[model samples]
Target: KVMGILPFSAPSCGLITKTDAERLCNALVYGGAYPPRCKKEMNGGSLELQFTDRSFKVYHECFGKCKGLFVPELYTSPNAACIQCMDCRLMYPTHKFVVHGHKAQENRTCHWGFDSANWRAYILLGQDYTEKEEKARLELFLDEIKEKFD
Candidate 1:
């Protein structure tokens, strides 16, 4: 039998149709990055998929490089506010999340601008919603953020 291994980064392979890719992306993102929890059929795969928790590195806005500084190595606190670059700890308040394919600017400046095109649709877990519902969800998220830090 012909078999191949896929990387965790590219969960949606070129061989997958758009619809199927959407389904897969939804499962990967909303299921807390676990595919098996979202889809039962995925459990039958011989391939072993392992992933780290939400931890990710930060490419310092100051230096602009990876520099082998991983998030897990830098911070002891659970809050993102506590996470900092290894070299410039407690210096820069805002740092890019340093994840591939997504640019999440960690801003504390209170500017509420969001690029609609940049929305990570895969994180929605295949839920179909109207524009009104989408707006409500966005507002709810914003409200929660305000409540958390206010």
Candidate 2:
């Protein structure tokens, strides 16, 4: 059963660039300078997620690239460079989440994102479980989440 649907967006406009997405994916798949760290915990470990604040880096980069661009109209038209920068910051994973108390207390990385073509968000689980097991685990986790919110 679907518990609830909550809408969320990135906190800032310049944070989701392709370069940062590549960097984050590399950090997750391989190893990088900034690795994943637990950003928040909720409901006594029922849910926890890894989030790194790269806002400073994103702001610096965006400003550096867009500072000098000329805007034809103030307020009415935005600078082209600024628009491009914002466009580059689209459709990246906001964070990585883990749902605890699953049988062996396994640590799983779930990637959540929206597919515009399908008009739905999907949770792609890690490869540790088979397809059937993945579905069961996800349902169990969703139930736990629903219980907490309800």
Candidate 3:
């Protein structure tokens, strides 16, 4: 099932471009970052979203929707490989996660962009601030996966 959707996982589909993924990642991060100042009349929780023309529609809209929008409950992707975030699931109880591998595990290693030290940064997110959000809010609920190593 994952192979059907994940671009990096699938060989046949090359529709996922580097820039497109980056844009999508940025949109999602921004949507998650800035919640509208409005609030639920009863609960006072923010119910907001900023949609784009290229957004996937349903899932994207709901990302900024109120808490009770869904009935059966839906689960989002854990390691948004395109954006490189890992632990944002700690925000809400209903938001679930898919654990890939332990940080110290040698098997789950990656080489991010090469840096100036001339040493390969073989760690999670390839040393490109994988888990850290370049735009996502750090002081909010998405703190667990904010640091380079947590």
TM-score of each: 0.20, 0.18, 0.17
Best by lDDT: 1
What TM-score would you give candidate 3 relative to the actual structure? 0.17
Predict model 3's lDDT versus the native.
Answer: 0.25
**Colliding residue pairs in candidate 1:** none
Candidate 2 per-residue C-alpha lDDT over 2-99 given as tens digits, one digit per residue, 9 for 90 to 100: 11111134333456544334334433452211112322332453322122231111111110121111111211211111111122221122111111
Order of candidate numbers by lDDT, starting with the best: 1, 3, 2
lDDT of 1 by residue, 83-121 (tens): 233332221112222211222222222213322222222
Using lDDT as the yardstick, the better of models 2 and 3 is 3
lDDT of 3 by residue, 1-150 (tens): 132112334355556444234333433443222123433352644343322231111111111222111111112333222121222211221221111211222212222432212211111112222355632332232233333222
- Best-performing candidate as measured by TM-score: 1
Clashes of each: 0, 1, 1
Q: Model 2, 113: alpha-carbon shift in Å?
A: 11
Stretches off by above 4 angstroms in model 3 are 1-5, 8-16, 23-28, 33-36, 39-150
